[model samples]
Target: MSVQEPEARATAVSPLGTLSLHVTGASGVTIDVAQAQVPKLPEGMAVDGVMLICVRLAVQITRESPMRIRATADQDGHPETGEWLESMAFANGAGRLQVAMRDDAWLAARGVAAEPVQYERQGFSQVIHEAPAGTALYVSAAWRIDCATAAGDVSAWFAADLALPA
Candidate 1:
């Protein structure tokens, strides 16, 4: 029997609202995810609707190596009613773990919790705020892992999805 490798996804969530998208990838893949109402930047900086973002991460040890993971969600809001959420996780062969969250712009950190998991450990972090009408949130969910161990190996992944009414 044979198996195929995972591929980067283009679209993740199908919604009845403004249509926010989630792109997921594993191992060494790149995923491009965005909402249908989000305006394209760089060539044309256009801002239209408001947005909310969230992220989570998990770490797994299969070989002899420590794990290092980091997840970040930066939501540039309109300084009144915007919110952002970011989370990260890592499974180092070492018996140690940490989780944290922060605020950006006019928003504040609301909640962050470490998930109770075994083998494949996970961490959850989030932030929320209401931006001043007529502005949107910049959702950025980013993660990274780096560490070493003497027992086995380690693997880390970060994934997230969201919905925003246009």
Candidate 2:
């Protein structure tokens, strides 16, 4: 068995609309991400042993539930959250309930590195935790924006099944 790392999707959205993060990584193909996560070697392939190429991003929105935030619609159709994100949890299998990045840091006090890449964006910083081989991960959250001008809350989420690296 080996490690399988998940790549970011081309596009991610929330219940509010399409999301555009100012900060992003390099193009997928250029990174050879697909080939890196494969469980088995291909025929006729030889040489070096298999190596685990794992990179995980832990994103955490710490606003309280039913929190209030300033938002405006972007051309992409998703609400462009202000300097801060509205949901304590947004779309993506990475979002954990009742758990924030700080909680993972607690492990470090016990001598564990949460392995999350801390990304500071608009309103807050998202904790991205890198998962090693044989570890399964899931992100499930429904993000709704209570836009000040709107009568109803705007909702959205991102979902994906991440397989553990073989």
Best by TM-score: 2
TM-scores for candidates 1 onward, in order? 0.21, 0.27
After superposition on all C-alphas, the RMSD of every candidate to the true structure, in Å, is: 18.0, 17.1
**What does the lDDT read for residue 35 in candidate 2?**
17
User: How do the residues 6-77 of candidate 2 rate in per-residue lDDT, one tens digit apiece?
Assistant: 234322343444333222321121111121222232343221111111223343212221111111113212
Q: What lDDT does model 1 reach?
A: 0.25
Distance from true position, residue 39, model 1, in Å? 22
What is the model-wide C-alpha lDDT for candidate 2? 0.25
